[model samples]
Target: MPYRHLFKALQWGLILFCLCFAMVGGTMAERLLELLQCQPHANPALRSCAWLPNALGLRLAPFLSAGGISDYPFVLLQNFWALIAVWMVALIATHRAARNAASTAALPDRGKTRYPGITGADAGRWASRAAFWVLLLGLAGFCMAFGTPILGNRVALEVLGALGCSPGTFDPFSSPCMSAPGFWTHRLAVYVIPLAGPLLAPVWLFMAFWDILLAWTLLTAAAYILQDHLSKRARRPAP
Candidate 1:
């Protein structure tokens, strides 16, 4: 039973890890392009900006509603989906663990318990920790990629310069204009101000940074929440 539960937990960990890297991988390229001020893929519909409210129940959007500590848009939906993926993985893992426990308990002798055919848990576990570590490394890679001057592309800054992009060209989570997030320099008490100041955009990349941070923060937080929820579920009395 211990082994089975551990396997199930690790399974969920693997799935969540995969999801973490997937978000960083899928959104990096295009969002980076937008951050670099490159014209999008021909009228895609994104319009180079997106939005969502902050934790304070205040509405916010890229380049529109600004000056709040958490105000920004969710420029990338793929990251949002990755967060959802984590929840699904956890649900499956817990259910499987529960089922396994029930089945094992039902047997008279229970000499050696084994699931004949795993409905969804058929996917056996081998080395989940190794995979999880790899995913963390990949996320670091994407975070680096999100930075200005794409690795090995010595001319990246020059290219941005030639294209008239901001000198502050940064990653999806950073302001392309190098502008600081509203809360960074403010005191804890001052950060509560809504529409505290005017938002100016010499370039669109500035807005992109806001959107990226907003989405990634929400997604990562959701991932954390799912992990906690699943961990608690596995401890509950079986129904």
Candidate 2:
């Protein structure tokens, strides 16, 4: 129950942050779109990057679509990715603290000059350091909804169909690419070309949707581990 609450809290916190991010990104895009005479009107609530300030210009969220993040779906993805980052950071910190405590306990404690917190395990520190990349990739996926199709053509198929050609007809093997009038989405089948082996398929999707599904799982696992370690710490009578 405690974990459930933590999970929900993380989810909601990430959602709230993502909404704020979307609003900021959308407002900036609207301003850009308006200046360029692309969309003409501004939709701060939606992603209409037209009259953007001269500074941002076309470089606005090069990875994410213009108005794509303004939508709620991507907001959820962003929040989830943020949660993943939080989880990773927490895990890293806890792991480092544990190692430090262990190493200190093992040391002779001669009061000599040494790093106060000496965690001998380099692996934890390294992985924890990698948390930055997790945040970066997660942020990218968060801003723009990363889609991995388990079934069906793709979520963007209809939008693509609405535009001109059928997205489904596009070669899935070559690239997991599909576009709408002003948007693009990918399916796992298209991403994991050959669509044959289980390992390759999941790995491909993991690479694409890592910020979402993989990140989510990693966060969940990290949270569990952190809670376990914290509980163990709690049970031990402090010195």
Give per-residue CA lDDT, model 1, range 1-239, as digits (tens).
Answer: 56467667667776655543344433433344445553422111223322111110111012232322232124223224444565576566667767777776776654444434333322312123334444555545444433323231322332232222223223322323223233221111111112221111112223334565466556555555555555465457769
| Per-residue error (Å), model 2, residue 119 | 9.8
Best candidate, lDDT: 2
Worst 10 residues of 1 by lDDT: 51-60
Per-residue alpha-carbon lDDT of model 2 for 1-239, expressed as tens digits? 33335555655765665565556655654555556653322222234442233223323333245445546346435424545576656555555655656566676757424535434444454454455456556655543432333422333333233222232333543322333223233433343233332224334455545556666667746755655565465468759
- Deviation of model 1 at 203, angstroms: 13
Global lDDT of model 1: 0.37
